[model samples]
Target chain A: MKTVAGIDIGNSTTEVCIGAFDDRGKLNFLSSASTRTTGTKGTPDNVRGIRTALEAAVQKTGTPRVYPEILLLNEAAPVIGDTAMETITETIIMESSMIGHNPSTPAGVGQAVGEIIGIEHLSQAIQGRDYIVTVPERISYEAAAELLNAVQGMVSVTGAILQRDEAVLVYNRLRRKIPILDEVAKLSQIPEHKQAAVEVALPGQTIHMLSNPYGIATLLNLDAEETRQVMPIAKSLIGKRSAVVIKTPGGNVRENVLPAGEIYISGDSEQTVSIDAGAESIMAAVHEAGTVRDIAGQENSNVGHMLRRIKGGMKNVSGQAESSIRITDILAVDTLAPVQISGALAGETCMEKAVGVAAMVKTSQLPMREIADRLQAELGIEVRVAGVEAVMASMGAMTTPGTKLPLAILDMGGGSTDAALVTEEGRVAVTHQAGAGELVTMLIQTELGLHSRITAERIKRYPLAKVESLFHIRLESGEIRFFEEPLSPRFFGSVVLLEPEEMVRIEEDLTLEQIVDVRRGAKKKVFITNALRALEIVAPEHNLRRVPNVVLVGGSAEDFEIPEMLLEELANYRVLCGRGNIRRTEGPRNAVATGLVMSWWSE
Target chain B: MQTNKPAVHLYTVDETLPAIREICAGMEEEGVPWKILRMDGTARGLAYRAATDSVLESGIGLTAGEVALQMRKVAEDRPLFVFADPTAEQYRMIGANAARAVKKKRFVTVQAG
Candidate 1:
């Protein structure tokens, strides 16, 4: 009988599979374990996580830590630059003039044009003067209505503004059917005695006047030049259910375009790409470099700061000098990241197209050797590096119930997408490509402008919805679903991730459709793009059509839509794409680790 | 700068005018030119006459009470519907739903054999 242990060190996690084989080759799968990777993948620090995983597996089987006769580690690539690239795009808010806040219910029907005034002096106002009455929360609807009624002939009450949700009640009793805007949370901030237009859309409608720049110009009687300044304010108010446009004397809106620096691609021939050119042009420059040796950002630029942080992180983890870190492969994806408008009055954001780059750095080979030595000394067993990760993954994938030889496998890991093909005669060809699962998360985080990786990961894993009302939510598919109770206020009227356990609120200025689009776009850009690129390299004669079958293995294969998306994308070549069900039990996971032990069966 | 008027105008009774007023308040501010038409008789008669006499060939009948009975009495061919609980929010939703229904080619159709 032979007992072997297989360890797979991934970018974000370390996994181990231990099993025992009888003389007749009957295998008993003992137990499997996983834990967060200690440092970066393909580094000596990975041994710490691997040991924890190994110990956990042994504990499950009630065996000592050194129970296995031999330990096999994946021959992981030595690329380290996957963490080097950074997104240089920054969201800048140049002005605070836009009032895009939507109050649930604004009263009255038609637009009201008048100067805003405090309700305390309704009797003192001129009889013919048009005025918008601002009613504070302390005033009751009946009292405010009576007060407005008393001055009906004395003051022209054109519109009513209230700090309470009395839009319907006040409108019902108003002597003049002027428009009323209610539920202004920051009622004190609204400037008094200013020319304002209160617009309350009917059921199933959006505000048209404030939403259009020309409408604002017409209402405020601004010339062409002045009209240009109010364009942002008008643009921001589009699609809101209701809005109030108060023309403050010094209120001015400006949208700033921040300058993102250029990227320096060092390769066989050195060249530079301006970050301002957008993602497509930047990627084209990176591609033109052909065999990139390293990438650097212009000094004192957003990209430069990102690259420095990445190097510093690597130095902290691997204890290597930051200057020696050479970023080898870069995957640049065009994404829309949410940047908080610097001077936004209502925390409004505009989607900005930015480039998200994930660069792979080349590190010394000593980390893996050191890991092996440490394992050998601790486990009292022979620890050896197995074949390439992709090849081993293919072998592990072959353990799936229906898989056979002459099949190709794509190992989509957190840091890289690796592919391997095994011929009918057992010949194997493997290729490693930068950009995989992590790139997708990074793209999602950047494009959605999510500040948390946890939220990005959740978005990548689950579908999204917008809680439109207290009791219902609109899914990305345009389906409205009701909840038994009122949703949390934090999640109300915001895009949220519908996780299995509960709903997670996303505070970005994105609708359900926009968030869903960002999530799906990121996955396609990284996984689909890398899948095609990786297949071509590993396929016979670099022809993807030559490979008839593809088995996806690794953590990313567990994604709800990735397998189906890949299947559709690869259908043109008649390629059968599927997730690897290792040993008909483990689904899409533990393939590389499982394959390590299976290699000994043939021997 | 566009001065084109809205294709349809609003018509409502006294009880329902508050909600319609709420709806038009926003519409007028945004240059959505619309006028309100008042009826002199019973709610049902007003809606029926408004639906038939309106030039726009569409009318949104607002009612604070029951709407299903009065709406059923209106002719099916006319693009008119009754909105119960005609608050500001409801009218806004009605306009939104109406716009969507027009785009989807299934405006205010009742399911029947």
Candidate 2:
């Protein structure tokens, strides 16, 4: 019979299962066993745990057999750069202020310079001459009214340029409504004279006067020469909001060019490539250089060697590229080139830094090859590791049952909680967060001050019991019976310690009732708190309402009160909650291992 | 004693008299032999007695290990089959311990049909 072994290396335990094909091609479960996992669960170092679990299963089955024909193992899924990347992205989005890009031409004519003030100065400034007024963002309608009242007779404020969102606020504040232009990027630059005819363009609309030469001539009431003079202003205002073209009496705008050079590539194969083609495209060509496509459409060895040769040549030339730039020396990272790097000098080598320092110097930046070499030496791992979440999701999908395709699984282990939702089409979305069983255990241990983890686990698992009197006591299992003799003085009036051997006397001061309450309260705080946190993190995008069924199979799920508590807590969602039948049908534990074997049948 | 017809009787303790009489009277109409085994404290003593008797009578065709396993199976099937007036704490502790034991034992079907 062809037998298959499935192994799951978990944080606290390793579970294994053996299955053989019966005469009818049905999977017959032979045996299953669990052993405490040695080393980290998901690491290659967990091989020892896998070996121990396999031995235990073999012993239980009492079958002296060689390694099964096929062995299926759950690939270790590790969190790589997700949380850090998320945090960095969020920080950048929040802190960024100015995001400027030069528009080809801006419309509007003439310069308007004046003291920037609120709408109150508008009436006074509009009496005879033009003036510019600034509207601060976030000021409400009512406040703008009072400010206008206070500045009734101030200097003439002919026109106003408001910040984003301030346009609506100021307009609402005015008793009489005026056309407001929103999202004025260069509001501070508006010149004084053109303020009246300068209709401010709103956020959604384009620069009107700039788009129409006839409109600019009519609004500014300019002669042919004046119209000509204002033509540049109109052109500059083409796409700008709140920008003033100061009639720089003698000012002219000209384009400046920074020097750029071609990156030359030389290899044993005499292949020339352009740096302007983009790094990814270049790398794709480099990777496929010498490979030839077979009838099966797969690259053969000849092409593979060519690609390797190019990669090797590229690594050697990277140093030369970096030195020629005369900024920071570059090296190619062995593991994950093209994604990350390490450098002694900051600005020039990094893309993010390059953007920041572009105004200072025009230094030539080297190709990615140099950066990859330096990263390989420093990080020990590859420069550009594959996305950890993506890898785990693919591996998890491969090991899970095909019939239950598109299923979501939460690996609630000790160090981290990993959740993967696989689609029927084979796409997988995965997320990972810190805090799970270990965190709950830590909470219990800290709260109870339990000396042993065994004791803490026991406390977490059980309800409570209290000795009512010498003659009788109440058990949490809903049992009450008369003692053959009077209860021992040690057990009376306090919660009895049920540890094997070493009976310690309970404190006589506390009543049995008080002890029961304390234990229940403590367990509730620790277990429930951790469970909710784990659930929230695992399914963050969707509410619990969407997750209709939750199959809990973990070390913590074995706790007596935990399952009941979870059932009650998740009752609102009407989710079907219970232990996996895999353990019941075969034996306790080894569900993941069994699933792995079953996955082979599916494939 | 010489008659071929079966006979039925009901037994009751002072504390459980009302409940016992209600159940016995209900069964008596159907002409079934019903008895209430009562004890002073919790129902645990009665359950223990019942379990012990059931184990002995059922032990005729099974090994000692099989007898114990069967007893546990019966207890799981009808939890009230082995009733105990346990305290809140003992209820929590023992229930949890028993569950842990069952889980550790890897019982295929904890509650026997």
Candidate 3:
């Protein structure tokens, strides 16, 4: 009988499994440990993390540190993942456009259109001519209402614009109630004398007229072609409580088409594909090129910058010369990037089509043997390099009681998605592809224009809810949650990430539906796409239908929804798919590490 | 004279007791000098007093629920502006002012809800 330790070093974490081989010839599972990986996978710096994980496992199991008969380490692959995004579309306003930014407190309901005029000038204005008063902050709501009341019949005040949160107050005091719009942060930017339309929907309702382009056209007297041009502007203002559209001569909306540039794929033959062809065509071109050796973006275009950034990252991780690193696979997903409208008074954003790419680069073979030697020397235990990571993972996956032979395992980690198939005869086939958890995070941050990876990560991990009222929040699924005490005022009008312990506020003014859409879409794009791609490569005859059972084992398999998403995707093929329960107790994690000990036991 | 000198005071109607308690507790922890002044008039009447009363200048007053349009009309320069008890939706409607006050912990100084 002998005691053994299995250590698996991954992109994001290091895991360890401890066990003792009984005289009965079964490896008895003992304890396991995990810690954040100290450095890039397949690098010598990983030894520090491996040692820490082993120490934890040994301490937990109360096994003598020097008692391990041997230590087994996974022969981690040399694949590296890098992600990038480029905007393909942008909204350009040719002239000063209307402000539709929803102020939390717009006053009154209903639509009104009239020429813009200052509140102070209301009393002196032409009689019987309709006007929308633009009230500056210096004028108190009472004073503005009093002035409007004095000229109520003499000068027609059809509507009012306010620069402060006193919309309700000012609206209540009006002798002749007109639709009032408030919280116009840039009140100074509203061009005076221009025809403006104000629309405020009642509580629990949305403004339909101002949110429509034709509505703005009718108010401003625009022709058919002009109305067509305002659709993008109108689309962005949808679902707001209030909106403002001003008429500016020669005002136009344009779509800014950014140059996506060319991508060079060097496989058996060198071929170039333009990213402008979209994701489908570009992928087709990549498939046609065959046995991809490397991919590079054009010299100065966005794709070029993206590829350079990837190569730079690989160089940093491997300490390899730039020339030795080559991107082996590229997974490109078509995505829409929301770019904020420049100079918009209300925060308006327009969707632009773009490609989100996760590239896998191959470096010079990693010296895992050197790492194993150093770890063995430090721990005073004989250490041996184990089978390929995919094979070890498949072995660990089989420990799940109900699993059978002819099974496939999907190992989705932070940087890559890998799959392996093991037959009853013990023949193993494996494949590694780019795009996983990290890629999903990149897409979320890029598509939402969050600008903060930390915030994007939180959004990816948590559910979302819109703070509709102090006592209640409407979740993405339309379920309402009520709080005993009032929630913090800062989270009052914004979507918040619902964490287990507390509600984390997302700084962006996005709706719960919009944020959830970005997050779920990103997960589907990366994990769902990569899962199918990796399985196809490892399946017999490259046909997934032949693979009967698929068990997920890795860090990403523990994601709240990824396993379910994969099961739904694989159901069409009638393939059994679920997260692995290694040893009937240990979760999807530590699979490769556990498998290492099993391999030695069989030997 | 020193005792008679006007300091930033917190005045609230009976309806805003819950919010006032929290604000006072926070203020106490920060070591800021504060006094609770009781209002004995209507919401609108309080605003008029804040605007004209010399000793009441630059203080804050908490109203019952929503700030009437009348209070906003007169509270522009009154340090004794009435602060209404803000619902989540109404607080968001007020926007930047509420955001700043909440972030800066100047909860007592926020304008009428």
Candidate 4:
């Protein structure tokens, strides 16, 4: 008999299968064994573990006499990590206190007047006859109050047109309880002689007047054309809280204001400045800087302020003498609110966080080459690492006996899942994904809070049976049956007493059902998700609906339930899924090794 | 039929096409009914195509061993030939012989012209 050895090095374990070919060229399974893979399974450092597994299989098979005619070698499929990093930065500039004037028509020009809450306005009267104007979305209620207070007058603050939930908090802090409108959608532009009320809509709710045309027309006293013109404003109030409208003569008119050129800076600065000097512009500039300064000065600020402080705090490292600093970039926004500025330094500090994240995801391929060299030096063997997908395809073809043609294979490993499609045209395509069995283990560990990975793996692999009564356990192959075996103390109440000697334990505290649920859910989220993604990416031009049969291999396929799970998952596409026949014919776990031997044919 | 005494031979060339021609000429002189197969568009296009198709129709019935013999004949000139591709139905026919030759160190020399 001519003996051939097949070896598979996996992330968690190394498997070996020894098969012998008779004189008639018929292949027969001899022996198979598995051992824990040491070091990195995907690296050349794993040769020691592979050697151990091969030795064990050889010992079990007792094929020493035939070793001369037999082949002894392991297949090397290198593991390389691929990662992608992306950074998205968005900046929004705001102008403060200035009215965004769109003067296509004149009745919309007047400033909105409302009662001052925390601060008085400049146009305050003894009787407090102020025009109840709507506030734009850009300005917060607190800033509105501050703007009014700085105007220097005994203005009775009643309500404001605010942007966010902080409106209620600002209102709560007022000395007097006034009618507050939270979401005023279009506060900057109000129609004339239109008696409209501002109302702050609750979260997840749209303002009544804004959603309905009739409501807006009734509140604003608009005719057909005017109502039609203001319909968009009504639509914009779909999710606002407070709004304000004024009763003006000659109907409402919209105005357009040209924006001045924007200022772009690449350094640090002390205060906000504007190219065109005007009361509104100056007020907006001051408001932007003042608000930022106050927040920075406060004991506890919001996340935005905290981020700014963190950036600013890193200005002078190592006590180097402080040099000239300028604002990095300034973007101008066409709003009455203050502009927001973002700064970045010239050195590594500016991009340190982003670079760190990118580095973590970008696992380099350099280590793989080094590992290959090391393995060659340690063991007198040539190790060539390749994508798992390629290896799976080769193995799939070898294991499927008498099946002549192009076939695809999917190898689901612990850390990654790979698939390779070989076409009848002799072309091959392969793809690899990051999440697989490891993710399932993670889910099981997290859900059960199991401290040990071994325990988690056990839960993932086996089914549970409760021992109703103590009984004997029997095995047909080994003829090693036991009776009247003493049960462990831990299996007392929860276990079903099967027999006097043997007790069947049902996992009550941590059951396989829970593990299956978590495992399947995680697989759906990771493997299945990645599978579809990889398939689409690999077969971009090919119609996936018409793809051929797929064979499954690897340790994951050894699980009794995994095949069924995959079959059900892939049922929609009418794809065929089954365990590789390698084990039945040549012993399981030798598919790759067999393929390695067979690879000599194609080389 | 009477035959002359057999003799072993080895030929090398700097380029792929010339090496392929020299090997083909040697095979013809040796009276070996061999075929050549090309995978994809690599190597000498005209020669590889002509060799592969002729061998397929060589009346030897598409067997892996037969294909390997053809490949071995061609390999005397072109070193690189794909014999086993899982996706192809004819992989088995060519793969068996190529594998044997590779093991015996009789396959085409990769770096030798």
True contacts kept of each: 0.00, 0.00, 0.00, 0.00
Cα error, candidate 4, residue A470 (Å): 5.2
Q: Give all candidate RMSDs, comma-separated.
A: 11.4, 29.5, 8.9, 36.1
Mark the regions of model 3 whose C-alpha exceeds 4 Å error after superposition.
A22-25, A63-66, A268-271, A319-321, A447-451, A463-514, A601-603, B1-113
Model 3 chain A scores worst on lDDT over the 10 consecutive residues at A61-70
Worst 10 residues of 2 chain A by lDDT: A353-362
**Between prediction 1 and prediction 4, which has the larger lDDT?**
1
lDDT of 2 by residue, A1-603 (tens): 667777665657878777887656677777788888775334434556666777777776664653455555554342210000000000011111111112211222233334334454455454544455555555443465456545545544434455432443454445434344435454444333332343545444555654354555565454676566554344434544433232333422221121212222233232333323333433343333332111110133222233333333333433334223211100001110111112111001111110000000001222323333443454243332122332333333333233254444545455454556555576655544434444445444433434566554555555455654445566656587566655543344445554455323343233345445545554354344444434543443656555534554556656555566767877766654554345345322455676666556655
Worst 10 residues of 1 chain A by lDDT: A89-98
What's the TM-score of chain B for every model shown? 0.48, 0.31, 0.42, 0.24
lDDT of each: 0.70, 0.40, 0.75, 0.41
Deviation (Å) of A408 in candidate 2: 3.6
Q: Candidates sorted by TM-score, descending order?
A: 3, 1, 4, 2
Native-referenced TM-scores of chain A, all candidate models? 0.83, 0.41, 0.90, 0.45
> Compared with the true structure, what per-residue lDDT tens digits does model 3 show for residues A1-603?
888999988889999998888888777888899999997787778989988888888888863454567889998877878777767777776556677756655667788888889987765688667788899988877788888888877887788989866776676677788888877777877787878788888877888887788788887788998888788768767877788877777665567778777899988888888786778887887788888888988988877887788788778766779999988888888988877777766556667788878878778766788899998888788999987788888888989879999899999988789888898898988777888888899888888889799998888788888776446788877899988765665565677888999998888656667787788889998898888888888888989898879999998898888899999999988889999999898889888998888998677
Ranking by DockQ: 3, 1, 2, 4
| True-vs-predicted CA distance for residue A60, candidate 2, Å | 2.5
**How well does candidate 3 match the true structure in TM-score terms?**
0.81
Error of 4 at A366 (Å): 6.8
- Can you give the lDDT of residue A525 in candidate 4? 53
Which candidate, 2 or 4, has the higher TM-score?
4
DockQ of 4: 0.00
